[model samples]
Target: MQTPPPKSNCKSILTCLLVFLFFQVFTGTLDAQEWAKKMFATLEHDFGTVAKDSMQEFRFEFTNLYKEELHISAVRASCGCTIPTAEQDIVKTFEKGTILATYNTKAFAGARGATVTVTFDKPYFAEVQLQVNGFIRTDLAFSPASLAFGEFSLTDKPRMEFNVSHAGNTDWMITDVRSKNAYYEVEIIERTQLVNQVGYKMAVQLKGNIPVGYLQDDLIIVTNDVANQEIKLPVSGKVSAPVTLSPSSLLLGITSPETEINKRLILRADEPFTIESLTCDYPGVTFRTGSEAKKIHIVPVTFNAGLSPQKIQATITAKVNLNGEIILKCPLSATVE
Candidate 1:
């Protein structure tokens, strides 16, 4: 089964930004006083020039790279233009958390910047500061804030329309709209322009065949502005399939031979479904399933290690009868020594 790409291996502007920050963040981590910075994926984000009331946001995700547990005491923003919140207060080894920064475009306009300071109190006492900078143009605005695709199914072709209004500049116009993902089409229609005001109607349509997963993407709006030419407009949605397994990737801790462990998982779908049978990709693994047909099913899995010491990597496939027949697989791993 296809999984979402990790923070390090992103497809968008992350590739370009990581190259420049990777060296700086790593080099700074070598310093004894700045060691905490190493855990973060990135230390900065530029929201670029956005329209008024755009409600832009960026997630500064971090992973615990050390052997000790990581704890976040507080997350604070330096300016009212941005608000920072901690997604998870405590993170285990190899686990992740985020310092979510939201840009307040409604109250603030032009030259918006903030310093997000994350305080750590457990396993270490340190603070990491992240930079967030963006320009909120008062001249430009969006009616609906974003292109909210909402939730749909695998067989849905959803579309949304938004309007862009610009005050003071009659020549202001959106030259082009661009998106990295090829699953959508954007149509720009020019609205009636006044002597000193401009407007545009943006219609976005998603194809029916988009892969099943959470779609968190953005569209780059190219404009004629000489200083700032690109505007970041976010698009978000989720596509549900016939069947899905929550926590598709399970992590089991260290284990030894003859040790058996039981874990529970959530199997879900839009419609009522029943698990016809369960199968495991590896030996010494079994599953306990129920017969009740429902929209959500609880599945218990058991894994017994072999006599030898090794790593356990397995996938559990469940034959589910929903609309007809659907296969759902969940990958799990553990370390046996």
Candidate 2:
């Protein structure tokens, strides 16, 4: 290699160093400014005292005061029981927006306090938390009232368990367990622990006959915990019934430079049930279930595959046998190519 160049001049080196330092300082100031601007509002109201069975909501509003377009990173509630709804668009800059939060007073009776935090983009990108308070009925409340088991594969049995905390601090009893649908069932094993806290081990099982589409049902747990009537907990999800595809999976048998092909999958459930919901994890995937079969009793699941990847998996949920007391579940599977 050639010899290294001669050393630089002291003045030139100093000038280069100053230039770099200037850029660093300028950028730092710009960043600091971006974090300083904001205009916000919230439902920040109090309901004071309320009954046990009634449900209510609290909404908040916010806006961008920056000269440039503003963006909101996220808006989250302190707890899931307090549902959060925010602006639909993310890249909204210097525009007006709103965030809505609905607190389910279901299991929250008596005096209660909760908060929601919102984050935005600017120089001073910071999180602002808002609070809402009210009295909730402590007669009977399901801690972690809502159960959302996201997306699961056909063979996967997703599960979660929560506690029942009383505000009145009174000891109550769960009398009976039942479901509106038959395909799925739940079991409650009574046990006492955690110092004065009492409840049961509730398990919901879906049968293999579950169709591919949407599945939903409610578990009506009759409890002396409440006055007279039984409280209900909803269990819901989308199901991907059984499916079959030829030469499964994408990019498997491709030999030509630009090969074009088409395929389909037949999806159907073994028993009758209504598809409560249908969801997909992948963008290239699609599904079709019941419109005609409103109240599915024993409907055939048909998955029509079209240029979809082979060897894909999905799960569907539904409510079956809308009567009597029983514990059961519906599970299904499908193949792609």
Candidate 3:
């Protein structure tokens, strides 16, 4: 009986050992993928504490360890609080890429933990999340922190300028100026003492290359005034060319949220004119002309703020069939007034 040692018990032991070996082999196969051996900077970084309204950037470095060329398809951050910038969304061949996590310390205050996700073409990593942690100061403010010079034509080189004045202390200074995008140009005209005001005059200029739609971006003002934190200046405007229409902006006085209103603008010449096309900046708005005749042709523009905000702003772009090849655009600014 001792020699028997329970044949069933022996079979159970052998089965358990086989199952363990199978799992080891499966796991090893998965671990051999390109991303399994990838290396990253620390799993997380602490930027420490910064001013309430400041600008800061945290960059994470990573590399590929596979023998084959590693391809990175995209890099994404967890929140708008952190803006991720990289040389290329798609990393080619065997190379290195950086995820620049720019935290708008102004928008996010107190202790925060954000993540930046990197995606690869390889099936190995559905997504790789990088972490960032920091403390944002809660004692800071900005006046006229945002600027919006509503819609203008492409023919017009419009320049909108705004000021950043601090009240807490004079130790603060605008350390850097950055645009959410690069098509636009922003410069500090003079960081000088103008009329006893110790601040800088920021000149925001746009090239009008933005697609014919709602154009918006944020200009980050990095200031030493408060520990190099950032304050976001929202820059918004419409792009238009010179058109025959008069009084470009449309105003639908204090209408109810569910109310719809319409107005007409004449696009006509002394003799005759043909409207090649009429386009509106906002999809929620549109325009139409009758018969395409030149003599005082009425172009009706409609506004529907139903269940929408009381104020609506946009641009009307007109392409006229003329020999001059003019790019006529006009702003259609409307408010409660």
**Highest-TM-score candidate:** 1
Error of 1 at 196 (Å): 0.4
Of 1 and 3, the candidate ahead on lDDT is 1
Summed backbone clashes in each candidate are 0, 66, 17
Write candidate 3's Cα lDDT for 1-337 as tens digits.
3676699999999999999999998776666433433546455665555545644665576644333455567777777777777655554332345677777776677778778777666634545677887776664433344466687755565777765554445455777777657746777776554343466666777774554344556666677754446655556666554446665445444556656677887765555657877787666677776545464667777776657554555567776654444445666544332
Top-scoring candidate (lDDT): 1
Write candidate 1's Cα lDDT for 1-337 as tens digits: 9987876667556767887799887666556337689878899998888888886878898866555788889999899999999999999865668888999999998898999999998886788999999988888888788777778875567888888887876877788888788878889865779878888887888875465666767788888877778888877787777678888767776778878988888988778889899888888888778898999998787888878887665677777787656656666776677
lDDT (Cα, tens digit) per residue for candidate 2, span 237-292 = 67542332221222222223223333332323344334444443433334454643
The parts of candidate 1 lying over 4 Å away from their true place are 1-35, 65-67, 209-213, 255-337
Report the alpha-carbon TM-score of model 3 versus the true structure. Answer: 0.36
Which is the better candidate, 1 or 3, if ranked by TM-score? 1
Off by over 4 Å in 3: 1-43, 73-80, 83-87, 123-129, 141-337
RMSD of 3: 17.2
By TM-score: ranked, best first: 1, 3, 2
What local distance difference test score does each model get? 0.80, 0.50, 0.61
Clashing pairs in 1: none
**What's the TM-score of every candidate structure?**
0.67, 0.34, 0.36
The list of candidate 2 runs beyond 4 A from truth reads: 1-103, 106-136, 139-144, 167-171, 193-197, 225-228, 244-337
